[model samples]
Target: MTDLELTELVKEISLADFGKAFKHQAMFNRRLRTTGGRYMLQSHHIEINPASYKEFGTDELVGIIKHELCHYHLHIEGRGYLHRDRDFRELLEQTGSPRFCSLVQSKARTKPVKRYIYACIDCRCEYARKIRMNTARYRCGKCNGKLRLKSE
Candidate 1:
């Protein structure tokens, strides 16, 4: 969705869930990485990770907005606003906001499935394996040495 849509969604969530108006600006930040959204203390503005929408769709966007709203409302009320605060936790529960921002990764962005990479303990020869092999049972084909984990 566009930045305007995200802004509107944030406002809607703030009012509907918190019964408080969000007076600050909300915008999409393409540079944001890993984090779903961030609440700026200085400006009281909320910046949402655009990657979140691209990866997890509108539902995820709503959840992130709700989470930021919790921070926004609590901070404005002079209550505990950090994630570790009891008031913040309670407000999150009450407002049905997600406690943590989950990683939103696109399936299309993933590389072809490659499970394991077995390497020779002695020569360091790597072998890509689709299935897990018993290290004790299987030896490296190159030098007949024990294999070690090179990849997950």
Candidate 2:
């Protein structure tokens, strides 16, 4: 749906589910990457990832809206709005909102496996690392022994 329709739907959901009006803007944010939606504390605005709807459809969109709305209402009312807060948890349960937003896939590749191995000269303690380490500057954690590049 369009941004305007998204905003209207958010408002309707806010009023119907929370019995409160949503006066802030709700817009599709293409830049949003990992999470389905985010509630901005400073602007009191909700930004939704467009990919959520494209991948998961309307039910997922509604669920995300509900999750953000929990943050929106609790924050505006000066109640606990953070995920760890009791009020936020209770509001989420009361509204049947998802505890976490659905994860969004990205085009970025996974990190390469670690290949470098460093060993302590005195203790033979080994460390696996993805990147090269400066042996001269670094020492073993247990014995402060000199470290050497053991293997790739």
Candidate 3:
């Protein structure tokens, strides 16, 4: 969502749940890597990770919003707003917000490992390759040593 949309969502949640108004900014911060969202204590702004919505959809997005609101409301009211604070934990439980911001697990990679290690028999020069090279035709330039497959 755009910054304006995020602002609206935060305002809505604040009013609905906390009976307060969110007077600060809320935006989707593309730079957020692992955290689903963050509440900026200095700016009193909320930053949501765009990847969270892209990967998990609106339901997940709302949860993140709720999580940030927990921080926002508590901090603005001069109560404990940190995750470890008693007030923060109580507020989260009262608001039914998640204790921690959820993260989108990154996609798994399946690329094959470069399993073969090759070495020149005479010069001991080493090489690594994903695919086995033809040792019969390949030789060490330094010593003209025949290359051999040393390990997989």
Candidate 4:
């Protein structure tokens, strides 16, 4: 859906769930990579990740909207709006909103990781690691032998 639809949805959820009117803007932000949505404390605007709605559908979108609205309403009223705050936690439970949204599959890392292989020159003991280690500074644990790069 478009930004206008998103704003309308946020307003509706705010009114229905919290009994508060959302005066700030709500829009889909494509640049949001890890989070479902974020409430801007400065502007009182809510920015939602488009991938959340596209991947998880309207149910997930509503959850994200509700989560953001919790922050919006609490902060506007000068109460505790942070996640660790009591007021925020109570509002979340009262509205039946999720503490966190579902993960977006597209943003998850799927690339195969490269492994670094190292072997001892004397004992032929091999070690596999995610990061490359210096052969000159490090020795094999088996026999204290010199280590060499076997393969990447």
Model 2, range 1-152, lDDT digits (tens) per residue? 88889999999999999999999899999987778899999999999999988988898999999999999998898999999999999999999999976665663347889899999999999999998988888999999999999889
Q: What is the full ranking by lDDT, best candidate first? A: 4, 2, 1, 3
Best by TM-score: 4
Which residues of candidate 4, in runs, are more than 4 Å off? 110-112, 120-133, 139-145
Please write out the lDDT profile of model 3 over residues 1-152, one tens digit for every residue: 67898788888888998888889999998888868899999999999889889998988888888989988888888999888999989888898888765557773335778889998887799888898889888888788889999999
Per-candidate TM-score against the hidden true structure: 0.68, 0.80, 0.69, 0.85
TM-score, cand. 2: 0.80
Question: Residue 102 in candidate 4 has what lDDT?
Answer: 91
The clash count of every prediction, one per candidate, is 0, 0, 0, 0
Ranking by TM-score: 4, 2, 3, 1
Best by lDDT: 4
lDDT of 1 by residue, 1-152 (tens): 67777778888888888888888789999878768999999999999988878877878888899999988999999999999999999998998889877686652245567699999999999998778888998898889999988888
State the lDDT at 98 in candidate 2: 90
- The models' CA-based lDDT, in order, is 0.86, 0.91, 0.86, 0.93
- List the pairs of residues colliding in candidate 1: none
lDDT of 2 at 10: 99
TM-score of 1: 0.68
Best of the two (3, 4) by TM-score: 4
